[model samples]
Target: MSLTWAPALERPDLLAEPVRHALEAMASDGADVAAVEVTEIDPDHADTAVLVEATGWDLRDMANCIVISGARAGEERVCAALVLGHTRADVNKAVRKRLDVRKCSFMPMDEAVGRSGMEYGGITPVGVPSGWPVLVDARVVQREHIVIGSGLRRSKLRLPGALAARLPGAEVVEDLALEPPT
Candidate 1:
């Protein structure tokens, strides 16, 4: 099915201003990012799982996962990471190692909502705080196109993987793994 904007993927009208600003900024940068509504699933759900059960597109050559979490107050601003969809973000070890923090944790729902300005389930990489770090898996660059969040849960954006790597603040890394979830 062709991808198009659907009401189900739109964020609530009450979204915080920062999130809206982020979207506008991305647009100003000539990114083809757009808001879309997708089926409401847990934000923590694996992208590979969504691809298999929802899109039915094998991600063997296209996309990888980008899991993000916020740092503790007075610590790094935010922690954005990339991992293969077949695997989970190495929150305890790899991620922590990279951040050089003694501890790291997922952003709380309320904090995420406040800081990201997007609803918990609807956060999209396209429209996030400008200073926030955007990590990408190097493997994703091999694919000409890939799918990612559209700043809402009910929708996803399909774009060139290379562009994703070039998004402002994005950093490509080679630490991603393909291990299956436990």
Candidate 2:
């Protein structure tokens, strides 16, 4: 089925507060963002499927999907989003390099939930903490629109690709991926 924007698809009962907040924030900024619900799949599993479907030039392309989790810095917690599938956030190398952290890792589940104020699977790139850095893959902008997480595993959000790059504290960058370990 084709994708379409519809608020009714948001599944409010399952919508994560951070995602809700992000959507509201984007709306306040004059962006037209909407959410759609679909079957849930583990990010790893989904990655494989996404790759199989992305033939031709699309394989190298980036899609805007939010993967929210708490990043650990000693006892501190930070929420983050990275573009989907083919690209890795370079969390260990590039992201840490960019953030100037000696070491970095995905936020622990509990910390991610606490900081984001949203359930683990429900986090979206939209309503994350104001100061949290948003890293967008430069390749994602090539698409006119993108489908990102809606703060919930069962749903996805659709919005202008450019708006994602404009999110507060977001920094658009190129070469966000690292070659998978051989």
Candidate 3:
């Protein structure tokens, strides 16, 4: 019997109401997109290290999503950056250049939460507003599956790395990530 395994994942519906573009685009396109698996978590355990330790999932298979803004007078330019667990976005060089701004900085937590409609730790790339650049490190796009935010701190999402590369405004940039310091 040919069985469908990917759909067995729980909570795909949780993303239903507002319909995040990232996930929606993948599902709608129906080509080269992997099924997504979502898991609920305690709000306090939403951070990387905590979630890793609690679930014992391989650290390398996880990616983080960060929201950043460019400094352009009278214009709102925001980008959602996706990098691996042990890596960080190269905000000063790569990101600034990509966003074509003089400076780029992490969006303030409160502002991020408000604009994303996602909790502080749960902001994923799925539902980012249209035209906002979703910068994804090339390294992340090769993974078979990676855990990312689910627009709510109470859950985390797992899907194909290729799927993330296809999200709206997703730009697969080389060297978008920098190794954490020693």
Candidate 1, run of 10 with poorest lDDT: 7-16
What TM-score, computed on C-alpha atoms, does each candidate reach? 0.67, 0.68, 0.86
- Candidate 2 — what's its lDDT? 0.56
Best-matching candidate per TM-score:
3
| lDDT leaderboard ranking | 3, 2, 1
lDDT of each: 0.55, 0.56, 0.78
lDDT by residue (60-118, candidate 2, tens digit) is 33353343333346544343655644666766666666665666677666766666675
Top-down TM-score ranking: 3, 2, 1
lDDT of 3: 0.78
The parts of candidate 1 lying over 4 Å away from their true place are: 1-27, 30-51, 59-76
Across 107-171, the per-residue lDDT of candidate 3 in tens digits comes to 99999888877777888887777777899999899899898877877677778888788777788
Candidate 1 to native Cα RMSD, angstroms: 5.1
Better of 2 and 3 by lDDT: 3
Root-mean-square deviation of candidate 2: 4.9
Clashing pairs in 3: none
lDDT of 1: 0.55
